[model samples]
Target chain A: MIQNLTTVWRFRHFLLALVRLDLRLRYRRSILGVGWSLLNPIAMTIVFALVFSKILGGDDLTRYVPHLLIGLAVWGFLKESATAGSRAFLQSESYIRQSPLPLGIYPLRVVLGQAIHSTIAIAVAVVVTLVYQPYQPEPTDPLAILSIVPGLILMFLVAWSAATIFAFVNVYFQDTQHLLEVAAQLLFFLTPIIYTAGKLVGKAWWWLELNPVQIILELIRTPLMKGHPPTADRLLAGLYLAVVMITLAAGTAAWLRKRVIFHL
Target chain B: MAKIALTDVSLTFTVHQRKRVTLKEYLIQTVVHRRSISTAVSVHALAGVNLSLRDGDRLGVIGHNGAGKSTLLKLLAGIYPPTVGTREVEGKICSLFDISLGFEPEATGWDNISYRAFLQGESPASLRGKMDGIAAFTELGSFLDVPVRHYSAGMMMRLAFSIATAIEPEVLLIDEVLAVGDMAFQEKAQARMKEMMGSARIMVLVAHDLKTIRKMCNRAIWMQQGRVMGAGPTDEVVDAYIASVTRTAAA
Candidate 1:
């Protein structure tokens, strides 16, 4: 494990270059360029706010817009990373066949690339929060900035591990790419993105507890949306999930690293 | 010193007949019959291949298509581990099986160069000085500024070959990549390869052109059906391989 980390660190520039390549290729020849990253979530949030505010029968636009924006941005990050990272290996099959670099870098490249877009979306969310401060839930504590540190770290760790696992599985089982697409759509509605988790009162709330995404989402949403650090329970949940995902990612890579080249 | 040694190395590829099976189909198949939905066929790509190389060995590999020539190079390059035997390699190996393997067409030639080098484990800090030399070698001066998508196939191959050969590797495994560019550039590339071979501790060249192999390699191995048929001086192996091919043709 230490050796793997060191190898990845040595090739950090490679990872950064791949991420830059991904971002550049994604928006290449487009007039808006990377502006699309910020525009996408903003557009989604507007549509969701319009539809959900009417369904919930609420005129409080500011309160729900920020909530929906932040949640959607986080969800978008997870969805893109998971889907893109799963195909990272297949996409770089040529490089894998020719180069001798560590195989793990492909998944890292996908996560980092999506992380950049996610960061842009989060920045837009912060701007929305400030603009709609009067109507939205005001941040209660300045210490919330500190909470974002662990929050962002945990968020990235979970996404990275999940992407790595998906990348490995997708190599052998090409169905994983399509499976993740459907799963991401299902997970979006299931997670408390469009609606607030607080609305579910009784046994239904336990459903949220069962979702690992809920804890990962709260890691960011609690500090960013609620203006406070995540509860100790949420933090512990994120930590536990991170441990399990990281172990699984490492185990899968070790077990399948040699064989993945053949599948590719 | 660069070295590679394989003791009874073998590789098998377990290919699934149906690569993509939906989750629903898989689950139903598993729950209903407790069996896999897709059948897997295992192909023995390489079998009981034993070889050893040390410093100053310019080894040539000649074989018919699908005879595991590329697999041997991949095993030496660390792209694939031996399925059965023990394999050990000590070197900063560079394998050039496909020159245009990693080029992002939407990226500029400058970026592609850096990207390819980085994939070969070359750090940006270390590659900065070498970039100019590589660009000069490609002769794609102003063209390097534009995206690689606009470059012609030969132009792209030039860029790829230049970047791939920028650094003198401790061990170099090449697969018929020397037949690149126009005649002038091919001669230049051959000269550059010779210079690289002079510095490289070990070199493995896999090519179908017997004359090229005999010219460049001191020793050669002929593979037939995933096993080494003959191994010895390049001239002897080439002569025997050619004799057998022509004899079969005459028959």
Candidate 2:
């Protein structure tokens, strides 16, 4: 595992170049590039804010709008990683056949590409919260801002691992991407992105803690929106989620990395 | 000290007979392993091969298609791991098997260069110095700025070869990529291939062109059906490989 990390770190520049290549190709014939990609989610966020603000987190547009924005940003990262990560190795079959780099970087390519657009959305969310003076506790720590650095790192770990799993899974089952796309649509409604977590008053609400994404979202949202880092329990929860994901990724990679080119 | 050693190596690919197997079917097959109705059939691409190499070895591999010549190169390059044996390679290996396949068609020649170079393990700092050399070699001029999808096959291959060879390889693995580019560029590519082969500590090439192999390599191997049919001095191997081919044709 350490060796794998070192291999990926050694090729950090390659990953950056691939991400840039993906960015340029994505915007090759289209303008409003990222804005257009995010338009759907941004539109969805607005609709949710208008519909559920009063019903859930209260009618405060300041609090609710930023919340929805952050939620959708993370959702975008998760969704794009699933959809694009499945094609990561398939698209790079030439590279895989030509040389031996760590198989991990291929999925990282997809994760990094998705991360950029989500980063922009997250930045916009932060700005909105600042503009709203943040609907937070009166004595929230100003130093909590530093937590965003760790927050982003944790988010990347989660995204990269999820993408690695999806990439390997898709190599084995060609329809994994199609299945995930349908699954993602269901996940959107099931996740608290459109509906506030606070409003869930039933038995299923207890299992929300098991939703690693919810933990990931709160880690970023607390520091950015509430002007305070999430409580220790939440941070630990995020850490556990990251560990679990990395394990799943490592497991999938161990099983499929060597023979992936055969399938490709 | 670049070196390569394969100890009793074999590679088997379990190719699905179908175009693809869905997760549902795969899961069902896995659960019902004994009574499975799966179409998974294993292809033995390489079988019980032993080879050794060191610095100053320019090894030529000749074989009919599907005889595992390219597979041996890929296995040496670490793209495909051996199923039953150990492969040990030292030094940075640069393989040029599918150099022209990964380019994004909608991206320009310049962009394709960056992408391919990076995949071949060139960092921005390293590529910056080599950019002018690569650009000059392609000679596409303003055409470099145009999307590669618009470029002819020969032009695309030219761009790919230039970028692929930009990295100074310590060990090179090539699979019949010398036959690319236009008439002039073909000679240029041949010279570049020679230059790269000359500089690398070790080089392995898989090709059907016996004359090119005999010219470029001091050592050669002839493979048939995933096994080595001949190995030794290039002249003897080439003669034997030709005899085998002629015998098959006559029969």
Candidate 3:
């Protein structure tokens, strides 16, 4: 596994080139360019804040806006990585056939692209939180900024692992992407994205901690929405999940590395 | 020093005959029909082949269709892992296989050049020195600024051939004769290929044209159905291969 990672690192320039090519091709054609990527989450945040604020009771832009924006951004990266990464190998079939590029770089290329788009959305969320405080909430805590660095690192790891697994799995079964789409939709509702986790307090509240994505989301969302860093339990839980996912990703790569070219 | 040693190496390819059935179709087919259809076709592309090459050896591979000539070149290039046995190769391997197929249509000719060079293991720092030479070889001129999607098939072939041949490899693997682009460009490409082969420490080429193989290679192997049927001095192997063909024809 370490050797596999070294191989990928050796081809880091090629991986970066692939990511650059994807980003360039994506934005070069449209006049709106990156504004299009920003538009979807921004528009979705506004719509969700308006509708969900009523359901959760009262006009709480401070709480709802940041929660909705950050939640949507995180979910967007996670979902896009899996969906797009499902075909990452197939997409690079030409390169795969020609040279011995580490297959992991294909999903890394996709995950990096989605992460960039999501990071932009997260930046928007942070900006809105600072600029649009509806309550007497002074979240000028520098620790919130420091805390997010770790959270972003953890988020990237999870996204990379998921994308790697999906890329390999989809090579064997084309239905993996379709199934992931359905699972994403189901998980979107199951995980409290638009809805608040505080609402589920006192009944099955442990479920939130049990779900590491929810924990990672809280690690990301707490400072923006609640003006404080996430609790220690949430940080540990997120770390544990990241490690688990990375191990799974490593295992998948080891098992599928030699055989995937045949499948392709 | 460039060296390649294969000890009873074999490669098997499992090709999926059809798209794998989803869970729904699979259940209906297995549970309801009480029989499952085999979906994979296993091809023994290479079987227990052993060979060695030292520095300055130019080996040519000749084979009929489905006889694994391209597969052997790819195997040497490390594109496909041997299913069994051991392959010990010490060198930087540069391969020219399907070189024209991997370019990004949305990218400009210059962008394609860099990326293709990158794929061939050329760092940007190294590519800087070779960039002008590659571009000049293409003769695309102002077309390098334009997206490759706009270029003609012949133009794309020129760009691909130019970028692919830019590298100075320790071990070179060529799949078939790369006679690409228009007649003028083809001659230039042929000359460049000859130059690349001459400069490389060791080279393995796969080609159907026996005359070209005999001219270019010092040693040769004749492959048929994934095994080496004949191997030796180029002249002897070519004579044996030709004799086999003619004898079969007479029979």
For candidate 3, write residues B64-136 as lDDT tens digits.
8989888887888778989998888899888877888888888899999988888877888988999999999
Superior candidate under TM-score, 1 versus 3 = 3
Judged by lDDT relative to the true structure, which candidate is superior, 2 or 3? 3
The lDDT values for all models are: 0.84, 0.84, 0.85
List TM-score per model, in order.
Answer: 0.90, 0.92, 0.95
* Model 3: lDDT to the true structure: 0.85
**Best model per DockQ:** 2
User: For model 3 chain B, where is the 10-residue window of minimal lDDT?
Assistant: B19-28
Best first by lDDT, ranked = 3, 1, 2
C-alpha positional error of residue A173 in candidate 1 after TM-score superposition, expressed in Å: 3.2
**Model 1 residue B123 CA deviation in Å:** 2.7
In candidate 2, the residue pairs with backbone N, CA or C atoms under 3 Å apart (3 or more residues apart, or in different chains) clash, namely none
Model 2, which residues run further than 4 Å from truth? A28-31, A53-58, A134-136, B25-37, B242-251
Return whichever of 1 and 2 wins on lDDT: 1
